[model samples]
Target: MYEEDAQLASQDWSLHPLGELPGVDSVTYGIVTPGPHQPAGVPLLQAGDIVGGVVDQSTPRMIDAAVHRRHQRTSLIAGDLVVVLVGRIGDAAVVGVEQHGWNAARSVGVVRFTEAGQQHGISMWLKWWLKMPEARSRYLESSAGSAHSTLTISTLTQLPVPLPPLGFRTRLLRTMRLVERRMVLNTRIAACAMKLADAHFVRCVEENKEAPRPAAVIADVGEVVGGMRRSAAIEDGLPVAWAAPAEVLRHRLAHLDRTDQTTWAPPHAVCAPGTILVAPRPGGVETVVSRIPLVPGRGMLALRVERETDRMWLLHELRSRSKELVSTAQGQQGREMSRKAFSRFTVAWPDSAQVREPFARIAVPLHERANTALEENRVLEALITTEFTEMAEQTKGKR
Candidate 1:
């Protein structure tokens, strides 16, 4: 490897191989086949299970204990850092107390730590280290070298771990915890706001007795447009934000403030603020309203709702019927929602503006509240990454 290719840290600290770290007991991948999800079974954490730097155990894929037994090597304990080896490769989340004894899916790699490691917070530091911008870029670069873009367990085991002095590492992590706590608080606030909006929508729907009418071009709404595919050539100069299907499907939030991918796109691809974005998931369509103007990537469609008040009403309308949106899908997989399918999907749109106004009055503030929390998180995430980079820089080339 070239000197520049190395993930550098201070010369004062020795770089240890991840698998050989004093705290890490073993490094291994999860089960090859978990079979179908079942009730009253062991919860299995997949690559997608890690969200926002934590394990989202709310709706984990439950597999038979028989299946889990075969993968006893990957059974998780509190503070064991789980890393994604496939789709969303390189993402890491520390196993929490709630998910103790749960197994992992095929695409996930479990880094089991010695009891001493857990007490020393080694797993958590590694998890946060992997999330830094530089670390992520390096991992992405390494994974992109493969045709299938995967990070193997064997490869992960050999990863160089920067060994900062124990005292300094703990102190820095102590401060970083404060930032993480604030982030968790914001996430909770956003989640509560979202639930409130959903409740309001449900109440509004229950009380309404008006007949549903077709959405019109001028009266109530506009047309539904498909997202355009972008290439690397047009994105060589200034960066352009493009929301990919994963971003929408994974988040599935009420409103989107920023996008993940970057590429130049056509005018039609750029969705105006408040435009509803719909993307397909495993069993349903995931929808969110764009808070800023940005381009939508492949497998994404934007619904143009000109009226600000109408935007909130339609967002909940589409979200509530997300499962039904797949009825118009063309394939057996049922994971793609084309523009034709969604355009044909009947939304509970009222022909008169006054009808939607009542629901929007209650829903709009809730959406704004949720979005406000998301915005703060966006800022916090950026700041946290920046802080990580700065902290690392402090140790660079130091004696």
Candidate 2:
């Protein structure tokens, strides 16, 4: 390596073998210190902490306080960097104030930057580097030996990192942080908007209480519909906007995939867009009834609304009764909805078309908002992908 590269070879901002990095320390596990159920004492870092390249401090398991007293050596500080040492290993994050209750173990590591050359921008810079596609390539190359695959501290320390000027690193971190802040604000706004939509829907329903109604009974899958066949040709084809059972829960009509899917041929006729999709098999299982709209993969039912009923109104009604619907499925099939139990399910519907106009007025804005949100997400993903790719390429020559 050239003289300029020598200084950065093993530290932050330098492209050197990670093993040569200064101040490297491996993680020690809490197993030897104490075990769970002893008492809520010290917090423990697990492999799950680095999810999608982010340290979710919320998941750190709490150890007995007594354990902390014994394992003072494993204590972590806010500036320390933690890395996963087990499955999917090598994922790393900077310990934040939120991690005060936590300490590293044998399965984790706490690496500190060398005192002589540590920079404030180093942490965020390293984080951004780790998220780059090139870094992932390096991680996969090092972890190829394991079936579950993991990055070791030794391997991570050996990976090459670009040594951009400290100011540049700071600029990059600021830009990324701005994006993150905006994302959080958007999330809050989206949540509040959704709540407003829900409240409006409920108010409209209550106001129309005196309208003429259709004769249908609200029932769970186990009460009326039977389970359909599970076999279907799964496809990723685009489905037209639909108001199916899933729509009732999602509160938005979106396309379902026809391709990349198994063909679900239910014994009873499949319901149309204005119908409900009930879990015929069961609930509480790791199944996605809400993600299915058109034809469901077996053990499901499609409840079509009567022509006189408004699709949106029926959807909101199902949403209001979601808890009741899911609960009724309990004790049916490991907490699932059975088809035989859903056959008799019915609901009260207005007999006239005029009753649906009110629902239509309330649904228009929601439909627009859903479409807007989906488009915004697609655009954001594209923007992030482009920006990250460009940055990684710019740093490629440095490495």
Candidate 3:
């Protein structure tokens, strides 16, 4: 049985340098002018084209026609393989069909299988080669400059591809394609959840815009507490939960919100449970609230809600209007949030403290649901990564 298998494999095997092979063509990298100097033309390949290892031609851009005549030979056809050379780096995709109007983006290459019979084999080969560890290392090694790193054609031409039997390559591609299809489905599902979260935020903001302001408020964040600082640990330390601004924004874990805070050493301020951990600096387009998560640290910054006040509702209020808090702190090096700035910030309170009760009813369940959905996405991402790693290893063995 072993001898028979060896002969069968031998019959199916072939080897050649990528350049020596006929029909395989490198991609055209060129510049296009927006004016009549180049009329709107061909479908261009972009770095973003390689999402989950497939070409997304859905958002193809048109270049000036004059530019197409300049780089006429680099035309894309159905069998060509497109590989990214910069930015996102090394993502590969197959050209679906000949697109006359489209031009290729910078630092991208195409491999066209000359022989029709060999097209599938070559596409699979290029895709698998791009994913290999050697290819990625070479890509990183070849990147130029201290500024924005880039990979050139010379780097790709020198990449060593393991030559395996056509039968083995085909089998490997088949298995991976199946896994990819499932992963794509999961990705779309996660995207839907994100869309819902965005919509919820929009609705809350609109509703608040229409509501009236409260009469008198006790204190804003700055008056209640000061900044927390922590140090890095070499090995181990007490179970002090350390949080960055990101965690706070993500969980929206108002006063009583809980999360597994990573531990750190001294110098880092201890965030006691109930303290509103805010991001010192806000980002992009109107400094909306920092995307910081308020953690129920081990008793730090706990809220002292009055008899009729709902702490959970207050957390949601802070979260929904985080952008405003961020905007108020704009200035002073665009860095840390000044405690003084936070202290003077105005919060609109409802006419009656009884408003907090109804607010909690809406806030608590939504908060829990958001946390559950986020956890699910994390788990799914991990599962996909593990499956891809194991499959790559198995395929490497076949080679």
TM-score of each: 0.87, 0.55, 0.54
How would you encode candidate 1's per-residue C-alpha lDDT over 1-399 as one tens digit per residue? 122112222234556778876677789988887899889999999888887778877788899989888877888888789998886677888888999999998789999877667666778778877777766676677776455458888778877677676666667778668878887888889889888888888887776656555453312265677676755555334446778777787784577777645666655566778878888877788888888887777667888878777777778887898888777555557655566656666667664455678877877888788878888888876776776677678767752
| Candidates 2 and 3 compared by TM-score, better number | 2
Model 1 lDDT, full chain set: 0.75
TM value for model 2: 0.55
**Model 2 per-residue lDDT tens digits across residues 20-42:** 43323332333444576433456
In model 1, the clashing pairs are: none
Show model 2 residue runs off by greater than 4 Å.
1-13, 16-63, 67-99, 102-119, 138-160, 208-385
CA-lDDT, candidates in order: 0.75, 0.51, 0.50
CA-RMSD of model 2: 8.3
Candidate topping lDDT? 1
lDDT of 3 by residue, 134-246 (tens): 56777777773434346666666666555455465567667656655665665555445434544454555466666775643326423344434444464544555555443
Candidates in descending TM-score order: 1, 2, 3
What's the number of clashes in each of the models?
A: 0, 63, 32
Best by TM-score: 1
